[model samples]
Target: MLSLLPQRILRLLEFIGFSGNRRFGLSQLREGASNHSLRSILCAFTLLFYNTYVSLILGTGEGNLAEAEALLEPYQEKYPKGSIILFYSARITSLRGNLEKARARYEECISSQQEWKQIHHLCYWELMWNHSFQQEWQQAYRYADLLCRESRWSKAIYVYQKAAILSMMSAEELERTGEDLGALFRQVEGLKQRLAGKSIPMEKFAVRKSRRYKASNPVPLVIPALEMMYVWNGFSIVGKRADLTESLLVTIEKVEQQLQNDPNPTEYHPDDSCLVQMLKGLCLKYLGRFLQAELCFSEVLSSEGRIRYDHYLVPFTLYELGLLQKQQGDFIKATTYIERAKTNYKDYSMESRLHFRIHAALNSLKGSPVSTP
Candidate 1:
């Protein structure tokens, strides 16, 4: 909760039009209100709500579930129909492992708004997570499909990964019931094939990949953590796309310096190196250095056995190459690269990525050489 004094300070600053500074601050006022005025009361209410929303978002990001929930509870009371508040509250609940309460809140959010399709998809995702926790394979698969239909790529990837695990569990259950294991294996293989050739957008994949790596590797945490902090400061200085390019260059330089100073170069993980190269490639692409980006991406793709697990790096690189080719009006090469990405997505359960590749392929086929940035 925001203190009354802080609220008064903010009001005074607003009154004096002292909103130039981006950093959060409190300024002493000349006089404090002895009696409540309508304007003062409204200002206080606005400040309270603004503080609560910011606290809830930051709390969730920091994994502070208790604080997030406490901040959201009052908003839920004051504005019962606010679906955004309910969604955040439910997210916090889900994070805290209270699936039943989370489900109730999500359901309420869905019921509160019919126009917001994203909320509906979110509710289904929550349900899918709950079902997965209980090892209910069939129910989980159904909800997963629903989520995929809604273009919830990250959550959809999670669902398909769970489905693969569940398939193995189901195989054991079926064996006890005298069912054929070979047939089950064949079915699983077929599903994998279907999901193989797709790719997710590079930007979205980078964000997810960074978070995943952050859990295990401390190196990649620096850039993303700094980016998060930049956002926290209201994106005041680094809000522009141009700022992102500068930041990316800085990060690439830092990574390069680290690599140069390392004694055992071969001992360094290929994934980490590939990630750095990929970031450089993305920055080049953003700066309209198409050929350079192409070379960087190509080098990463050609490097053998760099990634141990299923990663979207290859497909993402291929997709970007296609975009570059399209920009250069090389429709033939663009089509080939995008088609390759699509094939990879089909093999990798990256349906969302495949969707973008398909659009690119379609444009190429139609002889439309100009591509959207």
Candidate 2:
């Protein structure tokens, strides 16, 4: 508690892109959690949140699930009905790819409280992703729709998510939704919210993607739901489940084939296809098709000059390629590419998020000069 009292200061440091200060914040929380005082429990909770939730979103989705579980195990038994504990517990399970257990825990988390609907919203959000990982489109849509109707955290994201989920369904399945996908995407711009006098990075990304819907004759987004999932680093988590990754790969391949045969091309064609290719690389990397994965990532880099709308794609592909190179025993190449990604980009969609991943990659490469893998 005392250690985390200055957490807002630490967060401000991270928000401004200070990597060292974020490390210091985590260090202090670790020391605090080592103690046996009353606030030690609070410190543990803070650390657990950082490891289980914040790190996954802001870093590489490479959270320390083991440490998170060790911190929460005792308190979880002590306060089984504690909303925040249940939340972190569920998150740990989800990160470990235990969706069924996570779903039950998230349900318990929701039913544990009625006063703080915000807590319920968090669970709903996780539940949405849980179903999404399993390709349960309608179920995911149910949670996303609930968020769109009730949550005020980020209405643009919620509404966009609702529409994205609908996009994943069969026409007969989608006919039941009765919601206009284009109109919902268009609604994103109007529903966007600002934070701390600045536009939220993710909301801005969503609004930008939704811009096509505003065109006189809109071109449907190719697997926009998967695109958003990639932004959140969801692929890293889902990659652990072969079934999930294969399902996502199938969806992406469908778009890839469509793009190849697209007779009516737009200015954004290369950019769109490159985006799909990057996602395919991610899926392929997890599926152990490393050479094919490298090809997909290189295709994005090869077409970088042609990309118009999504400038972020190049740097992100570089980062992904760097990680793959790191895995293939090429430390110098990995370090060089990851550093280029870190230094050569700014203000793109989820740029900061990708920076954190690049930072993690660079750090590991520095620690393993001979290549860890």
Best candidate, lDDT: 2
lDDT by residue for model 1 (1-373), tens: 2222222354687688754231132121101111245454343333333343333232212233454455456667888778877877776665555657877888888899899887788677667655544345566556655764564445424433333323434355634545332332223222222235543443233334333323333332223322222222212112224445556466566875776577765423566566566666766766777778788888778863666433555675676577668667877777788777766555443445344335424433564644433
RMSD of each candidate?
18.7, 3.7
Q: Which parts of model 2 have CA positions greater than 4 angstroms off? A: 1-27, 370-373
Alpha-carbon TM-score of each model against the true structure: 0.38, 0.91
lDDT of 2 by residue, 267-361 (tens): 88998999999999999999999999999999999998899999999999999898888778888888888888888877778876786667656
Clashing pairs in 2: none
lDDT of each: 0.51, 0.85
